[model samples]
Target: MSMKNLDRHNRWRNKTVAFRVSPEEDEQLEIFVKLSGLTKQDYITRRLLEKEVVVQGNPRVYKALRDELAAVLDELRRIEAGQGVNGELLDTIHMIATILNGMQEEIAYGN
Candidate 1:
């Protein structure tokens, strides 16, 4: 084979590392790949290299806030059903609104 063809073949023959991922994780990876304008392999490789990546903190806080909001919504529904509004429920709603507003401001300001 020619030198160029030989080099190309060698490059193609290089072994790749494998990592296990849960199905949901794989789906998330695919979504990020699409959103990032990268191929799946390129996205994974860039992430492994830790280059220009933004990593968010654990989503547990967000999940907890979401659960709180859901509970508050249920309470609102009950209130509409004739149980009457409670101060605690109103406070919870305000807290959620504040949290969401803060998040929106942060996103808008690129913080």
Candidate 2:
């Protein structure tokens, strides 16, 4: 048998929740999770619970940010070459901006 799990509040987490998303949605979720530097389960749980997802800066997160920025640059170039702006790209940009802004605030506050 698999080991049981408990949440931060020491509540048992024995229930399973599942849902289907389109491939595009799945891709977006993956990107967000990677950027958040949180496990998929933790990311989804925090989001579902409407809890603040404070990202602790780490090497993995920095790498994800770099990769995402590169992808954003590529997308921007494609758009400049006559492609249309896609919502997914905008969402990625917004998320990245939010993360960066938070990091900046932390640095300013010496946190």
Best by TM-score: 2
RMSD of each: 12.9, 1.4
Candidate 1 matches the true fold with a TM-score of 0.47
Scored against the true structure, residue 74 in model 1 reaches a CA lDDT of 88
lDDT of 2 by residue, 39-65 (tens): 999999999999999888999999999
The 10-residue segment of model 2 with minimum total lDDT is: 1-10
Best by lDDT: 2
lDDT of each: 0.61, 0.95
TM-score of 2: 0.94
